[model samples]
Structures are given as structure tokens and as C-alpha cells.
Target: MRVTTQNGRVLLQNDVVNAAPVISTSELRGLGMESVAYIRAVEVEGEAGFAIHAADGTPMAVTEDRETAINAILQHEMMPVPLH
Candidate 1:
């Protein structure tokens, strides 16, 4: 798995292709995932938004509301840290 950031958004790249994929950012957090995830406030398409990313810089999700974004991470039982 490869994780990187582009245009202030996190991007995750996986090499393996399978029909039944189980491992995911939400899954990782749901199982008390030990990986570090980051929540960053960003502007995409000229609009304000928030993005969730893994410790290695993999993009998880993005939302327009900060609270919604943070809450989503919390709901998954993961910590959401602000970027910068």
C-alpha cells in the first residue's frame, strides 16, 4: 500500500486487486486501528472542506463541515487531529 498527498488531499494507492477487499480506513479505525489519522481543513474546488488522512498520508474522507468530518472519525473510534 502506498499513501501520499496531492493538492492538500491525501491519496492512498494499493497494488493488489481483489474482489473482496476488507482493509480500509474505516475498518482500521473501527477495529481500534492503531494507525494515526489526520483531519485537515482544506479548500477544494474553491469551497471549504475537511479531509481525513492516515498517518502515512492516505486520504480517507472529505466533508464540508468540520464537525461532521471530525465526528465521522470519532464514530469510527479513531482520533482526528488537526493539520497544522
Candidate 2:
């Protein structure tokens, strides 16, 4: 629902969920480039979750599930624009 930087600076912060991803690290990383960090509020089987991904879709970490996942996502301090 919200996107912010690692330093707590917000970019495209929002209270509601986004139907589509703000950005996909997997696609960008495939181009042989790497930078920044990002996380997303994802849904699986109608459940809410979060995925911590590097600029290249390599998961740095992922939350357990539901609130735990959301909490973990909240801690993301995206170092670059990708994360925001």
C-alpha cells in the first residue's frame, strides 16, 4: 500500500493497495544491471504478503505471511528510486 525509502523518506506512498506492481525488479535485473532495493505488498491465494527483492528480483528477504509480512515490508528502507 505504501512505498518509501530506506531512510523513511516516502515516494509513492499510498494507503490503498495497488492493482499492479509499481515496478518489477526481476525484469530490470535481467538486463545485467543492479541498483537500489524494493519491496511490495503481494497477494497469494487471496492472502496479503510482502516480498523483499533486490534490483534484480533476487529476494533479499520475504515476510512470513499476513501481518508479519506487512510488518517486515514496512521496515524496508529502499536505498534508491527502485524501492520507492
Best by lDDT: 1
Error of 2 at 31 (Å): 14
lDDT of model 2 at position 58: 68
Worst 10 residues of 2 by lDDT: 75-84
**So what's the TM-score on candidate 2?**
0.33
Off by over 4 Å in 2: 1-35, 44-46, 64-84
Residue pairs of candidate 2 with colliding backbone atoms:
6-77, 6-78
Q: In model 1, where is the ten-residue run with the lowest total lDDT?
A: 18-27
Q: How does candidate 1 fare on TM-score?
A: 0.53
Q: Can you write out model 1's per-residue Cα lDDT over 42-67, one digit (the tens) per residue?
A: 89999999888875577899999878
lDDT of 2 by residue, 1-84 (tens): 456764443356666565543444445566533545566767757766677666666676656554554345456544433344
* lDDT (Cα atoms) of all candidates against the true structure: 0.74, 0.55
Q: Against the hidden reference, what TM-scores do the models get?
A: 0.53, 0.33
In model 1, the runs with Cα more than 4 Å from the true position are 1-35
